[model samples]
Target: MDNLTHSLVGAVLGQAGLKRRTGLAMPALIIGANLPDIDAACFFWLEGAEHLGFRRGITHGPPALVLLPLVLAGLLWGWDRWQAKRGTRPKDRLPVHFGWLYALGFLGALSHPLLDWLNVYGIRFFEPFSSAWSYGDTLFIIDVWLWALLGLTLWASLRSEKKGGKWRRPAWIGIAVGLAYIGANWAISAGIKASSHSPYGLQADLIPSPPPLEFWKRDVIYRDPETGRWMMIDYSPGSAIPDAVPVAQGQPCAIPDLSALRKEDGELDAFLFWSRAPFATRAQGGGIVLHDARFYDPRARDRFSIALPDTPCEEPAGE
Candidate 1:
């Protein structure tokens, strides 16, 4: 999920009454919700696809989940002490409680992974211990519908609070509606995957590829078992009809024999590690182009794909 969604979720959690738990409850909640994404800082040091392998790993994993909130709680506590010493603490501020701060931090941090899992970009829930990726395949990376719903809820709740009216009600209702929307999408994804039939008797993996505002449509990645060719199809759960043509490149691409390149090139290795459904096609320079089936788009050729122009190309193992 995008940072905006994460921040909105944090604010909603705060408005939903967690803000009453401590002096900086809202700050802790909001910041903690986005803390996991701190791993993105690797961008400065890591190059190319390396960040892909590093991101959403240790940071979103079990150890980081526990440690990050503790660190946040300590910082919040330290800030309160500093404020007290300076005699600049707000008179109306609630007493700062480390226990409640930690609790709010935990809750907020937990929300990050849950929302991240709802998208096609997978999350590593138990990294360091296990580098496995998990996906929800329920929503697009950025959902305009969610932004609108969450943004409106936050606005309405804040307005109600300022006017001395019922504020928590709106926040709670917003959370409920968000959950229902996610549940519906999850059911749809699972149902489509279940009912989808591959004429070649292969399993289809459905990825939610709805436009920013729409959620009824999706795309699928599946392999032709007989030919070992991977293909993608735009599909709608309601219609259950598979498109006759594969998306992007009309013909399916083959999985290259990556054994030699995987061992020699660190960049390609990282890309392969991060790619969930990787495929390779011959490039114009006689090199191979690597892509993840879930995100490949012909219009955006440079994105979601890496080119290895110097390496000697090998025939695809499937060939």
Candidate 2:
């Protein structure tokens, strides 16, 4: 999830709890919610094989998400005790302090991966053991409907905190249920993928995407070694119905650097990542021209170029 959504999730969690200490709770909640992204920092260090799928790899993996929160909880407990012992006697009215705080934070962090799995790219929740990607393909990176509904209720709840707030509980219930339902939606999406035998749909490994839910647009893209085509499936929000698409036959490699990408370095690895994008093409001035094939209009060249050789791409542009 993005920062704004993350912060709002935290604020909403804090306020949803309806504790008077929600003000202090907000920071703890927000930090916990976005905690999983801590692994993103590793992007600067890793490259190639060691780096592949590392973004949502081990750190955001299921095992790590499960273990990290407990570790943090224990650490927070020890810190609280240490702080209390070192200073003047800690006040008794700490409200819901360590355990709940850690729980909230852990849940917050967990939410990132859980939500991320909803998109086309699945998270390796069980990393180290299993890299099998799992996704719901239900939500976009940012869901305005989710944001608006959850955010409005939360903001309203926070704003009206001074007086006896009414919508707060409803909001909490809505969010909790919605998150669970969001999870369910993905399960259903996977079921959809599992059911049909459409060659294109199978290759795309289709999943639902967010926004404009009614249209069931934003096809999911995946590589199909079997068909030697890029597969895509357009899925409606809740319905299992699908429309399949596959890469045109014998499409040029477009990316000349495929073989070289396997041997990754800094800039080389960066270029390798960008190369995966469907419409990405090498621009004359420099980089690749990326096309948004999902929204591509055959009439207008959908290809968008990006300058590369941030240092240099030894690989040719048009293979």
**Candidate closest to the true structure, highest lDDT:** 1
Winning model by TM-score: 1
Error of 1 at 79 (Å): 1.3
Residue-level lDDT of model 2, residues 28-119, one tens digit each, is 56766777777777657864333434667788876777777666666656656677679843475354466665666577777777766666
lDDT per residue (tens digit) for residues 200-290 in model 1? 2336544444545568776666664545555566666556566534443633335556789789887788889888777776676666678
Identify the runs in model 2 with alpha carbons over 4 angstroms from their true place: 18-24, 46-52, 66-96, 166-168, 180-216, 220-227, 231-251, 254-319
| Candidate 1: Cα lDDT at 41 | 97
- As a whole number from 0 to 100, the lDDT of residue 30 in candidate 2 is 71
In model 2, the worst 10-residue window by lDDT is 298-307
Q: Where in model 1 is the C-alpha error above 4 Å?
A: 196-208, 240-242, 250-254, 299-303, 311-319
Model 1 residue 156 distance off true place after TM-score fit, in angstroms: 1.3
